[model samples]
Target chain A: MRLKGFRLLTIITALVLSNNLLAQSIDDVLNRGQVHGNFGMDMQYYQVDSLIGASETPDEDVLMNGFANFIYTNGSFSAGFRYESYMNALQGFPAQYKGNGIGYRFASYTNDDMTVTVGNYYEQFGNGLIFRTYEALGGLGYDNSMDGMRINYKLRDGLFVKGIIGTQRLYFEQGDGVLRGVDGELMVNDFFGGSLKNSKTKLTLGASFISKYQADQSSQYNLPENVGAYSGRFLLRHRKISFNGEYAYKINDPSADNGFIYKEGTAFYAETAYSTKGFGLTLSAKGNDNMSFRSDRAAGQQDLLINYLPALTRQHTYNLLATLYPYATQPNGEMAFQGELVYKLKKKSFLGGKYGTGILVNYSTIYNIDSTAVPTAENDSTRMGYTTNIFSVGDERYYDEINVEITKKFSKKLKGIFTYSNMVFNQAVIQGKNPKKYPDVYADIAVIDLTYKINKKNAIRTEIQGLFTQQDQQEWATILIEYSFSPHWFVAIMDQYNYGNTNKDVDGNFNERIHYYFASAGYVRGANRFQVGYGRQRAGIFCIGGICRTVPAANGLTLSITSSF
Target chain B: MKKLILLSILTTLSFTIFSQQEKRAMPSVNVTDMEGGTVNTSEFNNDGKPMIVNFWATWCSPCKRELNNIADVYDDWVEETGVKLIAISIDDARNAGKVAPYVNGKGWEYEVYIDSNQDLKRALNVNNVPHTFLLNGKGEIVWQHNSYQEGDEDTLYEAVKALAAGKELKH
Candidate 1:
């Protein structure tokens, strides 16, 4: 007992001395050193209900997901680590994330024109068609960081080079494949150094090469041990007009996503835009064939993806339209086109009123590429599989959207925004569900959002939205009201009603028509925020930045907290 | 249970230390312009004037609302404070092409840049859009706020005003 007490006293004295030393060190580097971090927690309590298809409530009844990042930087040296805890995770997240661990940790330093990083890192090369490692953990939990070394060198003012060698993260563990890549970019005008930089037109060129190596362990087919992909990009800008293009090519890659087909992949993306005082226009087009590249050959779905294929569709913001029919890029083969126009009406005009009117028109479409199947002998699956033409577009339409929006300020204290969207969505092909069960859905959505300011410290906003469709659920109406007391507090209530259910049951009765209601309150102080809500969540596909995941229907009380320092 | 207790203790300790620390300078990171040119954020200086850096996206409604509200009173704020606002869009390649035209249509007079790959966002530890940061004359990150409510800009403007008048903020 005496020894134990002495040990405790010694420990306490040491801790106090260390604390003082830490404080003094911080003060010494106070001008140059800084530490910052952020933390987020999301917790939910679930209740099972069969009427709305929410029957998979966990036995624990309560689950939480949380992450925290702490970074310390002084001068050109920096270090950080992120701790993530998914205590059984949320309902829709992958089950592989079962416990707590350090998901990301990195240390880096910059000297003159060079920067070197070691440990876990995220990176992207040219449009992310060839390679990208990132984290998008909001609605859809997708994180693929790399564990290795990265070097960035600035040869000159306008020339830069990057080199990376690593193994990508697969859930909580590193994948089996090894990745190596190099990318270089140069600005032609700036490279020439003096007067050329002042020219009206600017030219930039970039190229990247990436390769992955995984041992061939498949018993059926002989897969290549190493696969390489290369891409070249160019950008030209003159005055208010800019044009950008990139083309990527990959050697034969056999992966699970492609059904083990050994076919070379190719992709091309091009975009041009013209912007002036009151009018701006943009056009973009892309063609991709067999472009699914993953670190693990057997990985499927949103796992171990090494590249990104952007979905060429308008991202709707309305509640019903966004949730009803969201599209994901078909990496096998696709051709897409998008166009947008933005115009502003002058103030003091008949249509503009006292405040200038803003108008936006956008249209986008994606279709399958033309492909012909190759004949194979019985029990012979070792062939090129199929042939696809680059320019030929097939008749199967994956997704299409046409939208228009108008924004106007009616008075000093009132403003309004109106939007209309027409969408043609093929849920069967996009969601990989049975086509015969879920037919094509054509929808028209309209939204009107208005905000009224009562004074400098108080305001109220309202949103009324409706979706009209002849297929899948028939129709939906949503109303949302939000009131803000300024700087610190906010409260909101929203209700979505499925009023038109055309499907009939065996008894010749209409399907269930239900309302998903949600109410939330939030408080904020400086860089910290706390919010709580209770709601009935509808089953649908939740997407952000073209990546998507399915969320099951649930009834729950939720709490979210976030803070940064 | 031990981990939870340790986390709580760390949280309390960090809060106290953070409140006592001095202001921190902004980190230097690379971001893209509308024309696809790379620009170092370290060069983002305004001749010893205050600046507001806002992170937003094309699909975020709350972000749009906040920017629109600030746009209405931007000119007055600028004239009063000599302040500049830089809008950074975190739109990836999918929607990055729309940022320039969208800004033009809204007729906003703020300078805009694109963080297509979210490099700057990650460097600054920004978790969400509609996050805004305020910088003092010496390019020190004086204050920041997450999310946005109706009159949050008023509080932001007040901070800028205090900085301009050489008054220390109370947090």
Candidate 2:
């Protein structure tokens, strides 16, 4: 810990000295540099209850997590660092994130057409099929930033190139593997100068190659020390229509997530859309086969994920629909499709009344990809584990969802939105549960959200939602009411009730029906906000962008403060 | 314990020194537009008019609600004050393809840009979405806010009006 403190001091001193030197040399040209930052902290006090499965309580009554980022930018040069403290990280966050340190720091500068950055950085290649490093610090606690150097150069007006070499961050330390990648993109029309710049149609093409090097440590199987993956992408747009597609292929590599199979991986993603005036339509499809690309072969569960496979299902906002059966992307092998249509009725029409009415309909589904296991000896360790063809969908149904939403304005002071959804979730496959332990779930959900403006300074919004199902906790209802008083203060209350739990206990009695309730009040002034709340949080899978983490149940008082300048 | 105390002191000192400097200009970072073209944020100018830059994502409920509220009164805001609202979506590659269609579906009139890699977001030190920045006619960031609530647009419009009228903003 002392060494960590010294390291942080050195970094800060170096940054300050560099900024001072640059300011002195470019006094007139650059002027005084600007410093901006944001700070956030979340503190929670816990209580234990065994009835609702929130039995484990921390030894420490209260847990706190905090972070602050400070950035200084002057002309073409900039530097920043993030300080994080997890005095015993809160529930649902990795326990490894306990303590205070400089988790991220970087320095970068740009001169004309070239830019260079050193230290910590986050980057993504085409569609993130091959390489991506990012942080989803919201409800999801996944931060895989790379500690390395990156360079980007603009060869001309239409062409751009980027190169990066780094080691991925694993907890507080760097990963064992070294990562390297390069990407280039060109806009065809822009490359032709101003000749077709004004044309209604445009075309852009890009390609990327990434590789990771790690020492082979397996005693039984001869694992590849270096694994490479390459991808190509294209985007074509013509007036109201647009199409985007990317295809990636990875060389044969054995990894723990893939059962140590030496099978090559591949993925394809394509989407097209057409839009005009008040109507829009989109269709997308994706297929993945043995495409679990990770920096470390032994890393499992959300660790060292070097790529992203997006879930094609619609992301619901209603609490019940979002929590009950949200689908997670299966990176190993899956085929999915999604289609959506959005339309608006013209104002002054019968259905539209004084304001236009909006409508959205969406449908999506996912299925396992066809694969035949390669026959091998029972004890044989070195063998190809599977054979599969691209786009060959299997018989197992993974997930399906259909939903519709309508928005209408009843009066100048009142507006309402109604939504309905039906979902079929395969719990055994997606949730990684025993097939005999949990049954597949089918559910229907409906929601009504209404907002009423009271005079000019105060407004009230309410949401009433219900989810009906026969399996897994049965029926549920939620209600939320929020009152906002213009630019300063707001208060809200939410209650979620699981009214139907039909399963009987050992005594032949129904399980306990629980009500999770929470209330919050916030004060906002310019760029700072302070909020406090007390609530009973139910245990569930909290997800963001298809990545999920199991959040434990608890009854607690929570306080959050955020500020940015 | 001694090391921790020393670290805290150093951190406080650094922040004090850094904050004493003058306000900084927006960093020049390259972002992608809806048409798949690269655009440098330093070149962002609205013809000598105030611009409201909003950072949002498709998945954030408050962000969608705020933008929708602004969309309802955007035309009048533009006519009253020659202010242009630029919406920058921080959607990553996972949902970047849905942004254009989503915007059109809602019939938003603001100029939308994609910050897929969050370059501009990090450069601006924006911690969360629904963060709005008010840039004066000269493209200097005068005021900014994090998060949103109902009727927040009214306060934002007031700032734009003040900038247009050459008056100091109260907030």
Candidate 3:
């Protein structure tokens, strides 16, 4: 690995020097070599549980993790590498990430009609039902860079094709399997020229096929010698409405999680939305079962997800109860539906008053499918692709939520929002394993947020939220305050209290109750910014940018600085 | 504790001073046009012309609507204010081939360019999609809006006419 790192660095150096010479030197350091990096250390000292689940707790320690990325881009040529080191890395971010090395290394070139990339790269097909790479940064950790090559070709008019071949990366090492795929897309109006261009209706068609080759291991018997999967999608847009959907099916493969036998799986997802002047609406549906299609079947969430299964439920970011019963996509036997509506009130209407108002309502539900109908006697020997009824629907519900929100601006600087939500979540799927035998039930939530500008230079924003439930823990409350001045700085303070807990300890104290408080401030000046915060944070499910991860509880201070030159 | 309070006061005072001095930072650019010729912003004037510069992506749905909505009124915009609109695409090579065709297919008369590397985006601080910036003939950025509403362009046009006629904007 060290030798490989040296080779990659040498190549980058050579590419930088050559590319710089090709371009006119702007200064002593050529403009061709544009370097940018992010360097920050999150040092957190943790106090162990000291009681239950305290088996692996270290006495007192400070954990630090940081990384720097540098890139040199000029014209059509670019190359970059990233260096990372985590001394006692964050609890949830993979422990094997402790070693210092070039986690990501890549080089690329592109022109008007063609582009090529060698080494590491990230790419995704439509909605990522077939393939997707790169991390979501704060939310998910599936950064599966290919250790090979990718090329894209632009054929006449609106036709484009992309092809890639390589072994997916698993942390610092390559996975045992090889992945190869190709995607082709067509913009309908582009092919027919002038007449089609004038048409109000537009259409786009895309297809992608990915195949994996993994050598058979002794632990699994009768594994498919070569596994292949194919997916296709189409998008249509006419005036104010649009629709898109993708479907995928995979050959049988055996893994420890599946009891060492092959079981074919399929997935389908589709969504349609319409919008005009002040209103927008969307409806979506998905069906997936035994289709947790990761590149390395044995690997968990550690850098091996090939395709992404978008959750059909809304992601909440509040502290306490917001995450208490979050819904995670169950890749085994589930069907789901989601709908949303948003409308903005007219300025002169009675409810709209002067500044106008906006209202939004959303609902989502997921249900389990009955699989007992499949004959158990033929499941072991038959090879007819795990017989599934072509258009059958399931009846058992796994999760559901309904949320409504109203926003009104009393004046230019004084605005407020009110929201109410009702939800039912299945802990059996969300938590992977049910700690409590009984599944979680429904809950009610409410939130009110208001902002007031005291003057031209000072402003304040506040939020009050509550969640009421009957299972596990009961009621929760949160209060937040923020003060800001334009173009420079802001500070925020928040606290959450779980005052209603059902369980009491031996001393008659609320064992389930927990209190958390945090204060943070940010300063922005030009391209450089700094933010720092400190407090006790209760562990919860965090979803940022559509990806979800569980964050562990901690008491610590954090400092972050980002700048570009 | 008194010292901490004093420090906080100083910080607030300094921030207020900074805010008072806040002036919009503008950049001078000579970007290459779709026809492969350089057009300097400082020299380009609307001259009573209502110009629309739209930043868009091939995958964003709202941007498509804004473009189509303008396309429906593009001829009128030209006849009314001699407006010249330009649509800049941020699609990389993976989807770059679709831009020109997509524009042509939509039959939009607006000028288009490919900012594949996003240099223009960084300069404009475009942190989100479907962002639009409206400039007056004096080449000064008179107004700007983030995201779009169905009839936002109408409001934008009214501002343009007022600015072109040397009248104060109603805001």
Measured against the true two-chain complex, the DockQ scores of the candidates, in the order shown, are: 0.33, 0.33, 0.04
User: What residue pairs clash in candidate 2, if any at all?
Assistant: none
Fnat of the models, one by one?
A: 0.47, 0.46, 0.00
Q: Write the per-residue lDDT of candidate 3 for residues A454-558, one digit (tens) a residue.
A: 765566767788988886567888887877654356787877777777778899877767667767776754334555667655656432111123345446665
Instruction: Give per-residue CA lDDT, model 2, range B1-171, as digits (tens).
Output: 566556655654555455544555567988888888889898888898899999988777678778988999999989988899999999886678778888898899999999998989988877677789998888888898877777788889888999999887665
**Taking the tens digit of each residue's C-alpha lDDT, what string does model 2 give over A1-565?**
9999999788777765765555455553434677788888878898786666667878999998888999887777889999988887888777888789888999999888998999999999878889889986534557889899999999887888999999988767788888999999998899887869888999999999999999999787788999999999999999989999999999976888888887899999999988876888889999999899888988987888888888888876577887778899898899999998888888899887788899989999999999888988633556678899978999888999999999888887898989999999999999999879788899999999888988677888888999999988899999989888878888888888888878687998776777788787888877787777778765454221111222444478877777888
What fraction of the native alpha-carbon contacts across the interface, defined at 8 angstroms, is recovered by model 2? 0.46
* TM-score (chain B) of candidate 2: 0.86
DockQ for candidate 2, please give it.
0.33
- Would you list the rank order by lDDT, best first? 1, 2, 3
- Which model is ahead, 2 or 3, in terms of DockQ? 2
Per-residue error (Å), model 2, residue B75: 1.3
Q: Which ten residues in a row have the lowest lDDT in candidate 1 chain A?
A: A542-551
Error of 3 at B60 (Å): 17
